[model samples]
Target: MNDVATPHDSTALVTGANKGIGKETARQLADAGLIVHVGSRDPERGRRAVEEIGGRARLLVLDVTDPESIAAAAHQVGDLDILVNNAGIMAEDAPAPESDLDAFRRTYETNVFGVVAVTNAFLPALRRSPRPRIVNISSGTGSLAWSTDPERAFAFSRGAGAAYRSSKTALNALTVYYAQALESAGFKVNALAPGLRRTDLNERATSADGDPAEAAAGAVRLALLPDDAPTGGFFSWDGTTVPW
Candidate 1:
């Protein structure tokens, strides 16, 4: 509702921001002059991330799998103009049939249910803002059509395990449902694929070495979208629409 842009006053909360793309997202948002709250399950790591950003970026304790932590985080952050649900886990093992069910459950705990918990917990604060935005950090593998399409490059690859991809698919669905609900409420809710980047989630030694800063750019763009920006859509780092 408010068209005024106040860099110093705009508040943002980035979940799982202690490292990787989340950390980079926090750093970039801080540099862009927004007050960023770096959320991490580990206080020490969160503090370290904040120090690395070196500005008004504060550290907040948050574990998406823990409902209490999510509530506590919402209470701590208070009102927010942007909420970036960047926290997620990947399946380290192989695909389904060979994948560990426990690992799959754990992945869902953070990737699926965690997103629901965190978003619901923060909806009140988000509603208070004139221009509220929610960006769910998703992956390209999550797109069933894209991954299954014979013409798609990813389809030819078999490295994409099942749990991680399925969880992201569920996340994309969640994004759409939330976006529809918030349509009349005046908020933008969408999911974004940051592209493959080298991060601990992929086992530090195994991931592709891409700049996390570059990956976070898409998230920052979605988070800072104007009130009129489209919601309930999937997008890649370059702002191109992604298949559901």
Candidate 2:
């Protein structure tokens, strides 16, 4: 493993950081003294978030779905210590049989392919860091193990978000594959389940028990892990292992 560094000297890039869990993750990371790049597809929003952060946070206008944008972002950052893939979309009521192919395509575009593009783009920069960590924001809904459990609360709604759920499952797989491939290079890659938050992605539907800030904790924790920390793991906000 590479030598671990203090947060004050490390740099991090968080996609979809303009709002919601991504924003909170960026905020927390910056608070810990990391130079954070707040990436958003919308330039104005990105700038706004940077302004709000008002410290080491900078605006990175990035659309993970856009190859050109990903390339430009890669070019902009000379070095990176941490990468958080938090951008994703949801299409309501996209169950099987009657599922919309367009919805599935759109969901996969951002949740799956977009991650691959962004990760590949930033690979060089990430490698330059003494200790590189990659955190992919995932969801419990994506857990095939949990979803199949009749006792799980989310299992009842499992049939509903086929597109979104399947996309996250694929994302989890990507995280594992990347972790395995990069292990010898001293790169730590893990998937974090932020849980459901009150965000536009879910039309602001939130659980009273859920806190957006709390949800972001998992990502932030994984981002600053020690060199010997476990990679290729799936974790929840409380640091518990999440079933695959």
Candidate 3:
């Protein structure tokens, strides 16, 4: 394992960091002394967030779904120690028979394809870091084990968000694959179930009372994990393991 430096000199990029959990994760990482890149689709929002997180914070105008944007952003960052894939979209998918295919396509475009694009684009920079960490912001709803439990809300919803949930499940698969492939290279790739935080991801999340900062703290924990820490694992906000 390569443990070369601490957050004091590390650099991190948190996608969709204009607001919500992404923003909080960037803030906390910056507070921990990492040079943080607040990535947002909107330059104005991203700049505003950078200003709010003044210390070692810079704005990165990134549209994860856009190939040009991802490539440009990756080219701009010469080196990176941490990557937090926090940009995701949720759609209110109906039951299997009535669900919209377009919704599924849109959801996968951002939650799954977008992550692959961003990660691959930044691979060169991340490889340059002695201790590289990649944190994927996933949801507990994506857990096949938990979703099957009768007491779980995901089960109760009867596959209401089949598209979004399945996309996360795919993301979990990607996490494991990336970790296995990069283990020898000293990269820690993991997924985080941030819980149902108060964010604008969807109507339910916006009305929810969970603190984005609390969930973001969990993400930061994964981002700065020690060299020997577990990789390709799903963890909750409190640092406990979650079933795949």
- Choose the strongest candidate by TM-score: 3
Model 1: per-residue Cα lDDT over 142-187, one tens digit each: 9988998999876876745788888999999999999999989888
Put the candidates in lDDT order, highest first.
3, 2, 1
TM-score of each: 0.94, 0.95, 0.96
lDDT of each: 0.88, 0.89, 0.92
Q: Which stretches of candidate 3 lie over 4 Å from their true place?
A: 1-5
Each prediction's RMSD to truth: 2.6, 2.3, 2.1
TM-score of 2: 0.95
Go through the candidates in order and give the clash count of each: 1, 0, 0
Better of 2 and 3 by lDDT: 3
